[model samples]
Target chain A: MASGNKTTLLFYPSTTNVSAKIHPVVLFNICDSFVRRPDQAERVIGTLLGSVSADGIVEIKNSYAVPHNESADQVALDIDYHHTMYLSHQKVNPKEVIVGWYSTGSGVSGGSQLIHEFYSREVSNPVHLTVDTGFTNGEASLKCYVSFNLSLGDRQLAAQFQEIPLDLRMIEAERVGFDILKTTVVDKLPNDLEGMEATMKRLLALIDDVYNYVDGVVEGRLIPDNNIGRFISNTLSSLPKISPATFDKVFNDRIQDNYALVYLSSLARTQLSIAEKLNTAAQVL
Target chain B: MANTMARSFLQAVATEEVAPPLRVVQMEGLAVLKIIKHCKEFSPALVTGQLLGLDVGSVLEITNCFPFPTREEDDENEADGANYQLEMMRCLREVNVDNNTVGWYQSTLLGSYQTVELIETFMNYQENIRRCVCIIYDPSRSNQGVLALKALKLTESFMDLYRHNSFIGEKLREKKLSWVDIFEEIPIKVSNSALISAFMTELEPDSPVVQCDLDRLKLSTAPFMERNLEFLIECMDDLSSEQNKFQYYYRNLSRQQAQQQTWLQKRRTENIARKAAGEEPLPEEDPSNPIFKPIPEPSRLDSYLITNQVANYCNQINGAAGQSFSKLYLMKALQDN
Candidate 1:
């Protein structure tokens, strides 16, 4: 809460602390940068471009890789390149300022403080995102941290990277593409007609899941959760009430319209081809 | 790793004189996300970017991309935009990413991207890059639970005719090209690294599906259909106007033809009279006569684009209607039970 880190939590109250919400793009960007890193480099760091909301949530939306040379004893980042790239990104997206910095590796390293110290001057309480690109534990562990200054007497000696809560959020459009990518790894993507079947199948599966849970609770086989019951009922009540005849008519109308549209489009294409042919034929005179 | 493979492919292909015919546009998952983020962030306002990838054998792989600076309407800003792109690519090259300019991408609204300006942009790119694709992303259409991203390229035959500034019907017939031949859409394949795929698997909850999948089953598709209809009607009007231009051209052409016939008839009679009188006869065809001048036929490029737009809208409406029908029936069955 802001009681102790009041200067850091400018947008938060004393109770709920700051949390980091990352968009899928940022994670993809960090992974890309790590994949394209210099052959000898251990980690790749980048500037996180996003904005902080009034509720103390840092939403990272974009990022660009910053070339850095790090060793066991020293670390050097191309400060000029970072500033120039940030300015270039700013020209297009003025709203997304420097929210934090992201690095790829297992965990925070000793030189992270130096880099964090540099970023602190650029932004206050900047977030340090560590993506385990190494896949250390059979998976990449996404960890976001904030540093706290450790002072001995009056001199600040070091900054500690304290872990914070991180959540992954994606927009509807991104979800569509991500779904395709995820599915492509296992099988070929579905076309238009197949897409409809896929959607219906998923919906039916979800309904079955909810029905089973509710059925178990009703039979006293499983303990019922009030939140689950309310949510299920809410969705149930949202369905429309109509006579079966009216529903059949509406369904028929939809199918007919869809067929008509497809027919019209194909007809238009055929006409276009014919028109082109005739126009060219007439030009011969 | 895809990184080393992409680089080796680039080296192998860059040395070739003529690249093989592109069979697919394989895009890295990272590139797709970057495009989605850039486009969704600035919806309604048009945005474009550069795609950096390798043109491997029979497959144009898009490994990375960066957005261009949103420019002002001036020549100075135009130059600045170019410099910014170069600088950004330079910075990316320092980090060892794909820096080759394979093509560019732009966001559209409701699939209104089939335009002359788009063709002009392609022509501009053709000067430097031999093979490039223009990725079109429609943020508005993506609301319908479909990934509205496409890679388009000018058909080689169309580009050849376009370069000569000739959309003449005679040339089109000779080339056997049609309106639909103006652009070729290459199929897109999404590819990702094994590490990224594993990471994504970790991100999922105990459930196999995402929470957002519920939105796909919503029965309210009225807005999407309405917008498609609006665009379709506008395109129809544009197509008619294009047709009107041709009508006007043919009318004037007939008038000119009639005037030439009259002048020729009079000249023949005059020549006969002059011969009887032993004087030199006047030439039947006069180079200085205004009636002999040729009228340039209007180009059919605009109408071709309009037709393409109308077809795209119709296809979209059909897809959305089909999806909505399925959702509606599922709801109906649920209600009955």
Candidate 2:
């Protein structure tokens, strides 16, 4: 839909469910492509592949970088390369349709509209995701936008990029990997026990924070919010009742069974090593 | 200075003669996240992808990865899989990404990844890549607050034995390679660029304990433990059957030995009679006798895979139980206080 306007017309998509859900993998891919970009290239751009549900929620699942050349006045995209990459990606994930395109920079630049138009030709309405890969404002700001086609009299090609709500969602395994990636100073990946220890420590810190907040509110040093109070109470109530005696008995019994198997495995391993040694000795003989 | 140069040259030669074993698998954070997303998104249905990176000395650096096409969707032609991989790698190379296939990664369900299929995939990769590893990620285990990602490779001795296709008892004995020697695990190291680390730090929510951390506090791990136990029992049964096959082979071999002994004695008697009669005796070894036929020894590959799977399940159960114990104790203390 277009309107003859002298300036610009900002219009949202017809559907009310216009929000976008972005997988952390897409962000990781964008950042990676940005890092591996050519030395002279100022920014890297790629096509976002996902599916639009019946409810109209756009889920961006996967992406691959598309090579392009741009300058102050001229912009050119490798349409052939984009087509081939899309076909190959489709062969892998047939369901992941081209939903939008992403670029790495401070925000949407002047040449983004041309790329967005190219993607729009592929899909109905393409989203434009601009990642602040440079961390210009001391943080990498991730922003997603859906464009509105504004008909400005004779300039019927112009469009405006409108910001849309986007959330970073990941599965359980991804969160664990993300947590591990957060530790940049320690390059070594944590073992299971170390992960558990860190988790416990974080839990303990949280408990202390909650306890302090309650204490402050009770002592009248801070105003108690009813919403937080209900939230804390609800959490406490959700915990199942546990009698110390019953729990101890169940816990000990389960732990003993588990430890017994652990011991059995250890014993099996010892016998294996011994058997290997014996076999080698007999072979030599 | 001349002496130093000579010593350096000698050391270089020594290093070339004995290349270092892959002790650490250095994976980029981008690769790690990419793998997690791909595997978890398709979850219950297992998926695999090609790993691209360099093989540095003593460290296998994984830089990037792309998911493989689902078999059913790959135009129903098996050859398309290889073509897709080649085209994808070529496209990625054009984008300045690492296209060298270092290894491949696959998602596993409940740590049950040890299989002959996996080994076959490894042998296929071995043809081109000088040294490679298979990275196994178990999403089910990670759900229990454990990041179960491991890098595994075929041991040199085991690979040598595998190439001969002779996995007999004697062959294994000669190689001194037990079932445990089939796969060697290299420790994994995860490192992120400064900018990614900063971005991840920003991704962190205001709360110290996110949803995953809260999920760790969940006390009900009985389902996970139960599934692991079920798999363990099945493995034990399979292992016992394998043992029985070996037993049957041994029995047949012993009977054949006794038959040979009797046949040799008769032939000796006949020869002695012929000597007395001044006539030639028949040959002792009979090629057509069914009793003298060789009984083929069964392959230990099946048993080795089962044992590996069993050990994997055991470790998983132990880890989940241990984590649960910690959480329970913390909860108990919190209540008491």
Candidate 3:
């Protein structure tokens, strides 16, 4: 090993045809009491840059900023202070490795849980987590298998890893996740979403107006007055001239643009039908 | 001495059967002209038909009886020089006065039954009682009609004046009395001779007609006399232009008086209530009270000037006698002739 600002290592696999570039992953580990001592935490984090591999290609990075003063005797207290780091590995051999460590005491006395998640980039499925507990030292090992065949340009693979609406249950699961993705993916997605949102808000306002109008009509708040005539005239004026035709074409052509107008007209038609039926029933009675 | 002789002569004429059919005929003719003239004032259309010898319809017939219709009739007579004297006499006898006198005997009697029917029809159509009677006695009818109309017009004018005078009398009485007390006392002392005499003296200097028994007219007119005078004064006051300062003064005085009365009544009630509650009574300071502020005296000369002007105007419109029948009756009589 050459002691310099950069360091390099060459790995030769037993399989001759499988040649690969292995970029070293840098992990920064802090002591349980380090964050409690601001000076010690700064020293630990400040010294991390010197540990980088010579290739200067950092493939993955993970760090935990935990409150060091957390109590270790109480399980609830220990779990409260526990910092979690999630890493996804698509392929490669899985092995237990001491990624990094910091001293909690003069001797290794405290232990921690390690969790590893693996999944194929092509298919969307439940992530597989391998958790190994019961370490008598303040150290844990994690296995991350980076696939040799994985193309660095495949950002779409990360998108496919997103939770999709498969069956009804997944659809429910995606609601919260998609909401987050929607905000994050704003710059990444198409431009039509903004216009769609605006249109949806307007549609909701119009629907609310229709509901009020219907309620008013039902409650006899809407009476046959000058305003009623004017409203009808104004609404009709907004509509394009329709040729005499069946009710469907008339409704579709003239009223489809204004939901409130369409709803009112439909209500009016329904009332007219009811009135006609009543009249016929009355005559029979 | 002249009044006594005139009275004795009238008495003799009433008692004695002196055959003065010719004088009666003359009077009858005059009465017809008077009636015709009065009726013509109401509707010139009647005069037009009489003058032009045009056939009359039920509309004209009714219009001929009304002093004023809801609206003026069309086809009013313009020809005042036509010879309608005989025809007018006949019409008067036919419709208004007696037909048996010399001046009216040869005149075509529309017949008593037919005349009554025509009058009934006229009344039905005209509907207004005052106007209908006025037109019925149009001088264009005959001399008898003219005389009757003249008497009627005089009576109406007198009644109007008497009404104004009585109103002033009542208001004067109300000066010292409460409205409730006035109303209560009015019926009791209404026929009191002293009040009537005072009212008459205050209104007119020529108090009684001893020669003629006009007691019925006096008694019947007494209550209304002061009222009629007050009405006349008001009419005169109103007829004066707004520029007349006297009118303004009088109106302001009336208003102030009304306000003072209202204030006094209110204070009286408040005092009675306070006394009942054992509260101190308010001091009675008359002139200090805002409502009792004295009104400026009106210029009597200016008022007289305005009143004279209005009276002149009324006289001009009403004609020389200031009788309602004079203008209308004379116009109709001349037109028919």
lDDT of 2 at A227: 100
Candidate 2 CA-lDDT value: 0.80
Give the per-residue Cα lDDT of candidate 3 at B236. 51
The lDDT per prediction is: 0.80, 0.80, 0.28
Q: Each candidate: how many clashes?
A: 0, 0, 62
- Give the alpha carbon lDDT tens digit for every residue of B210-286 in model 1: 53455565667778777788888788788889888988998999999999999999999999999999999998899
After superposing candidate 1, which stretches have Cα over 4 Å from the reference? A1-16, A171-174, A177-179, A183-189, A209-234, A243-274, A283-285, B1-18, B208-212
Grade the docking of candidate 2: acceptable
After TM-score superposition, the amount by which residue B164's alpha carbon in candidate 2 deviates from its true location, in angstroms, is: 1.8
Mark the regions of model 2 whose C-alpha exceeds 4 Å error after superposition.
Answer: A1-17, A152-157, A169-174, A216-227, A242-285, B1-14, B72-76, B277-290
Residues A78-193 of candidate 2: C-alpha lDDT, one tens digit per residue: 88899999999888778889999999987777888888888888998888788898888987688888877766555775677777778764553245746676666445667777
Pairwise DockQ winner, candidates 2 and 3 = 2
lDDT for each residue of candidate 1 in A219-259, tens digit (9 for 90 to 100): 99999999998998898788777788998898788777767
| Residue B144 lDDT, candidate 1, scale 0-100 | 53
The interface root-mean-square deviations, each candidate in sequence, come to: 3.0, 2.9, 56.9
